[model samples]
Target: MATFDSFFSKRTLIGLALGQFVSLVITSTAFSSSELSRRGISVPTSQSFLNYVLLAIVYGGFLVYKRKRSLQIKWYFYLMLAVADVEANFLVVKAYQYTSLTSVMLLDCWSIPSVILLTWLFLNTKYRFRKFVGVAVCVAGLVLVVFSDVHSRDRGKGLPHFKYGSGGSDPVKGDVLVLSGAMLYAVSNVSEEFIVKKGGRVELMAMLGLFGAVVGSCQMYPEILANI
Candidate 1:
């Protein structure tokens, strides 16, 4: 008796949890791998571009299979989402250059509160007292993590010796970047929620992937040319 909407309702929490786990793994692995690599590692924009490319391919295939008609939403809307997503990914990835993996991960939780506030303001979504309490707890946790950054000295042998991005190995700068990225991610997520609710498109994810790939690739082109 579970309908399509029911599947999303049932799995939303689970999906969120799994997504967090996967993101942590990806970030941590990227940090560790880049430090150990002999050659220069991929930059944040390149990594984001490549990820979206694969995503777009998969999603494009899905659209082909489903035989969906024209894209329901405006191209600019997807451009907005793609820009937010690409910016978030670039910022978060760049943050690793300036701070510990632990610090970046902890600070990235800012998206939860950011999303809540943005949804309230733009989406007109309401929350209960408990939700606010949860945000308070998240704030407390962020404070603890930020304070902990001052005591962190474990860079380990695998980490790179030189600075990677403009962040320049400053924990505060890194934390700020992570927090900013989280806010952008919140924006993208809230927009996606609104689009899904209003447009009622089951293939929203695929469309996002397609648009993200295009925008991300375009953004990466300049960096690639400069580096080359």
Candidate 2:
């Protein structure tokens, strides 16, 4: 292993910074095309930031490598992460097709309850009633947000802008899908937290990153090939 001085050397930081910059540029460009190809899904840049966070995970794994812990990777946890990642993205995109961002985000409030239960069940994590109250307060705020959005939409030139069944879609169902996706995400988070407590985050994350990529690729490749 490198000495602390060497690991924290100016040369090391410079290299890391340069590598991050290059990675950011590459991922930005690649996903830009992916976004366009999927249709004009103009996601809020801020919200989409996490979508590109896999790169950071990859970098973190490398840091673990430098620390020279264990390099062996598990594939199962990675598979779960990959499935969760793709499902969440798919849910968000499909929700956008049916509902307003406001309603979708409101329903994502489901994550709070889902995650709390997840922690209690899997991690044995606990919280006071006050914490539950805090979650309730946040959920109420989310409801208000959706109400405001719906009101604004109703006042606009077109209200209930989407349809229910054929051709187009419905808003309420979109909210449900968002909630489902959020629940899945919470499950993934809790699962990873459990995994982290048991194993090294670096190796686990690297494995998860690679596994998710492969799983997502398998799901996507058939569709792409069918299109061609």
Candidate 3:
């Protein structure tokens, strides 16, 4: 007979994987839709503001509404995480605007190494030599992808454009920014894990979404105020 632990292990793993897949699909679809909307269409500031308002509500609801009773949230930690989260997005978007999208995407791959290093440092996690080698190989693959940014120089269609080197599109600056964003995201992930391990209640997807929406709305308050 299978033990309860064994049964749960399989079920939990499957659920987690499925949730991740679904989340990835949803996220990718949203980005694709955003890009399509941008194509040959100039969105007005009012429209963008309205979009942000909707985004805030959507994210807040998705991230933190349902798990109210058991949600042992530490606001300070969340604040730090939120700041990093905001900065990461800003940096990546800026990088995208200033350089080729291909370069930005390629440089974002640094997150793997960033996460491993951070996990080792903060979480005190250890890895086998093979895992370290695997990370190295992955980083090498990222370098190859960066090299292939040559293909991205044709933009305004679907693909990203590239302008490598100085005075054109500095891959160095763009990659650095994207790399930083990836590292920040990794840190945020590890921090969330830490939070959960420390008995912070399992925030339902809906709850998380809600919290994210509220927080995102708050983030835009300054801009809203400025415009007003």
C-alpha lDDT of all candidate models, in order: 0.75, 0.62, 0.58
Each candidate structure's TM-score, on Cα atoms with residue i matched to residue i, is: 0.74, 0.62, 0.60
Lowest lDDT 10-mer window, candidate 3?
40-49
Q: Which lDDT tens digits does candidate 2 get at residues 1-228?
A: 699999999999999999999978855653453344346443322233344358447755585557665544455666777678667666655566556544664566678888998899877897999999989898887667555544443444353554322112355556666777888878878877877766667655666666655555555555455445
Query: Which regions of candidate 1 deviate over 4 angstroms?
Result: 1-42, 148-168, 200-202, 225-228
Which scores higher on lDDT, 2 or 3?
Answer: 2
lDDT, candidate 2, equals 0.62
Report backbone clashes per prediction: 0, 1, 24
Q: Rank the candidates by TM-score, best first.
A: 1, 2, 3
- Candidate 3 Cα errors over 4 Å, as ranges: 1-71, 144-168, 204-215, 218-228
lDDT of 1 by residue, 1-228 (tens): 777787778478699889999988877766663462224444677776766777667866777788656767777887888889989988888787677666777788999999999999998888999999999999999988776554443432245663432223577777888899999999998998988876545456666777788877777777677667
Estimate the lDDT of model 1.
0.75
Instruction: Quantify how close model 3 is to the true structure by its C-alpha RMSD in Å.
Output: 7.1
User: What is the lDDT for 121 in model 3?
Assistant: 93
Evaluate model 3: give its TM-score: 0.60
Which pairs of residues clash in candidate 1, taking residues 3 or more apart in a chain or in different chains? none
